[model samples]
Target: MVDLTALLADLAAESAQLDALVVALPPDAWRRPTPAPGWTIAHQIAHLAWTDHVARLAATDPAAFYGSVIAAPDPARLVDDGAAEFLAPSARLLARWRSGRTALAEALAAVPPGEKLPWYGTRMSATSMATARIMETWAHGEDVAEALGVTRTPTARLRHVAHLGFRTLGHGFAAHGRAAPTAPVRVTLTAPDGSTWAFGPADAADQVAGPALDFCLLVTQRRHRADLALVATGPTADEWLDVAQAFAGPPGAGRKPGAGRRAGARA
Candidate 1:
């Protein structure tokens, strides 16, 4: 079982780091477009803030959140237009985002450990919910960081995201309208500190081996699979990498190879 408190602490730290980077950016930087098509830095921040608000609603008031946020007559257009709706002066948007993140953390922490929280796609335990939040935080932060030309230090916290990716392999497949392979696929990664981080059974035949950073990048849609140094063995595992995704909802059109890399960060 994952340590919920530690995960919350890491989530807070990740949020704080992103906050520092965004808050310090000059006014023009907020308006600059990110790697995500049509999304400016302001859009990224607004997306996070709005998602946090929705996450809080899911945890604390699922029925209400669903009625209002999910029940929108034009859900697709709402999402498509969402990043633009929360725009404010850079300072106000940042402040709103920071406050939303803080409240989200608190709201998630209040949920009972074994109870499930309703999400758009699936119900999640407190640990899973927090881990998903961290994954989104890190993944979205990358877009913001890349836009500002900021290089971030990858941390062991990525193990959480990598684990989520590996664990949710079935969800990724099903979300994309594909059959999920039943065979266990091992993932062996070299952590930042040079220690090995392995997932799945040690003796599993199907396997993926690479840097933890690369694995996280691939699953989060931050780095296209072709650009990642990940090696997937066995037919099922290889095919899995072809469409690996860490987040839920509809299978999104992911980044093209070399399309989203930030300057001065690893290729």
Candidate 2:
């Protein structure tokens, strides 16, 4: 069984870190555009709050969760005023996010072990669900942090994000409408603690090796893969980096290497 307690703790810690950054931002900084085009820092926080609430519903009531998201008033404006209150006082919105995430943790705890919870695209176990939340928190946190020119120290917790990134390699390809190559690919990432974390079949001819930070950044769509130090061997693996995404949903038009660094929404 997955350790729900530990997973929740980790997710909360990441949330708190992002919260601290938001708390310290100047009022004007809140309006500054993040890497995600059309999404300001405030928008990022708002989206997080909205998603947390959605996560809670998914955990506690799968039917309603699907109904609401599928029938939302306007999917295009879900991140704007149509979803959560994006213009609420920053402090209040942040508190709501904190509270919602806590509620999500509680709901997840009530889930029967091994039973999957419904999410945006597929069902997720409590463990996978929590980790997905963590990944979203961290990835969006990067957009907020980068907008403020903040550089955070990478941590071992990133291993969860990295694991997700590696696990989703095929999803990334499939999401892009490409048939994922069946050939085996290996990943060797140097963790923040200097430990090596590797994935994929041993002696696999195809491989990706790089710093965990870059891997996480790539999968999160926070940075263009070409600008990072990550190396990919084999043609398929190499091309995969161009569109790598640890996230679900439609294949994102990833950041262009050396393109406008300050543009784009944190999709």
Candidate 3:
């Protein structure tokens, strides 16, 4: 069984990492535009806080969770709207994010065994919900870091993000209005510590191999697939890389091929 406590601990660490990045920014810095078009650093943090608040509701009061968020009149604009709704002054936004994430962790921990929490379109176990939170926190942190010209060092915590990337292959296809391929696609990535992290069938005909960080960036739509170093063998695997999305939603427009490159070099 997945250790909910351990997952929550990781979630806390991920949130804290992002919090540290923004907590000390000058009030004017909060308005700096991130890679996500019009969204600023403050929007990134607000989005996290908004999601955490709704997720807390999911774990504590499912009815309110659905009624408040899932039932929004315009589901397509829900994400952007949530960020706008939650946007606040830097100090207030930071405090709200910190307190909200803590409450989310407590609520997730108290969820009954075998219970599934309602989400954007589906239900998730407490562990899965926590993992998703970590993924978003890390992904959005990338935006914040990039906005400040910072390149974060990858860590083993990415194992969770990579796992989710692989598991959501079908959802990625569905979100793009494409039928998911049935062929097994094996993925082998070199972790931050130089250990191998493999997923899918060992004998699968299709395969993807690369650094775990690149794969996570690809699936999260944080970077264009071409900007990543991943190699895909076979048609299905190759196509999968193009439309890979780890988060639930419509297919993201993603970054341009060279948009996320570091100073004078590819990321």
User: Backbone collision count in every prediction?
Assistant: 0, 5, 0
Off by over 4 Å in 1: 260-267
lDDT of 2 by residue, 236-259 (tens): 789789767787677666688785
* Every candidate's lDDT: 0.82, 0.82, 0.89
* Error in Å for residue 70 of model 1: 4.2
Task: Score every model by TM-score.
Answer: 0.94, 0.93, 0.96
Per-residue alpha-carbon lDDT of model 1 for 135-218, expressed as tens digits?
A: 988888888888878889999888999999898788778877889888899999999889999999998889999999989988
The whole-model C-alpha lDDT of candidate 1 against the native structure comes to 0.82
What TM-score would you give candidate 1 relative to the actual structure?
0.94
Candidate of highest lDDT: 3
Tens digits of per-residue lDDT for model 3, 196-239: 99999999989999999999999888888788899999999999
Residue 109, candidate 2: alpha-carbon lDDT: 82
